[model samples]
Target: MKEQPNLRDATYQEEAAIDSNSTSIAGLVRQLTREVPSLFTKELALAKAEITEALNTTKAATIGMASGGIVLLGGFIMLLLSAVLGLSNVVAPWLAALIVGGVVCVVGMIMVSAGKKKLDPAAFKPERTINSMQKDKEAVKGKVA
Candidate 1:
């Protein structure tokens, strides 16, 4: 009863029996050179796009935070000015409270306006480039699954 040859094992053994002298590292590298550029280009583009998106997000967040801080500081300054005006009788007996109060009010209004401009939601809305990048990312993720 002769044993049947294992075709898978025989094929592997036949491949291993090839002349080792026929292959070289440079030939392997040459083969890879033909395949790698397209893959690398795809990966590089994805990375660049991801980085650009992250930077834009950071810029938006920073603007939002700075705006919030400015608004809060302006409110605090307004409160302090009110307190000073109320205590005018003791702090500066001769100073005209109305003049100082009016000036402070003007400054507060300016701060409020500046803060509002900074925090304007429309200003930070994603541009067309960012929107397209987001769509591309979503498409890639969809394909991955």
Candidate 2:
């Protein structure tokens, strides 16, 4: 009885048949032209998806920062008023306001710094899309050569 070819050998034979069918340079060029546009469209879709995801992430961060700013402003106003009242009898009221304002200013600065970090351009880079594009570029080059 004849033995069946192993999967690997069968795959190789199939690939060989395909390669032989397209052995001509014109065939290769036709294949490239047909495939490259499809590949480009897929890459563009991936890039668009990644950018949309990044933009969504940025939107969330922006909302957080905006919320933090509003809260910080309200907190600063309330705290300053309370601190001024509480310290008015202990120290000059102006000095108390100045001290409270400085502390609140520091807290706002911290919030701003955190927000700035989140908005970093590097963090928004479409890493997977970039890597995929590089691989596709190499693949195209190999096919051309």
The runs of at least 3 residues in candidate 1 whose Cα sits more than 4 Å from the true structure, single-residue gaps closed, are: 1-23, 86-89, 93-145
In lDDT terms, how accurate is model 2? 0.84
Per-residue CA lDDT of candidate 1, range 37-74, in tens? 76557656766776678678868888998899899889
Which segments of candidate 2 are over 4 A away from where they belong?
1-21, 68-76
Q: Write the per-residue lDDT of candidate 2 for residues 1-145, one digit (tens) a residue.
A: 9998799998898678668858787768877887899988998999899999988977887799789889887986786798889988798988888887788789879978986776678976889989999999998898778
TM-scores vs. true structure, each candidate: 0.39, 0.73
Local distance difference test, candidate 1: 0.66
Instruction: Estimate every model's Cα lDDT from 0 to 1.
Output: 0.66, 0.84
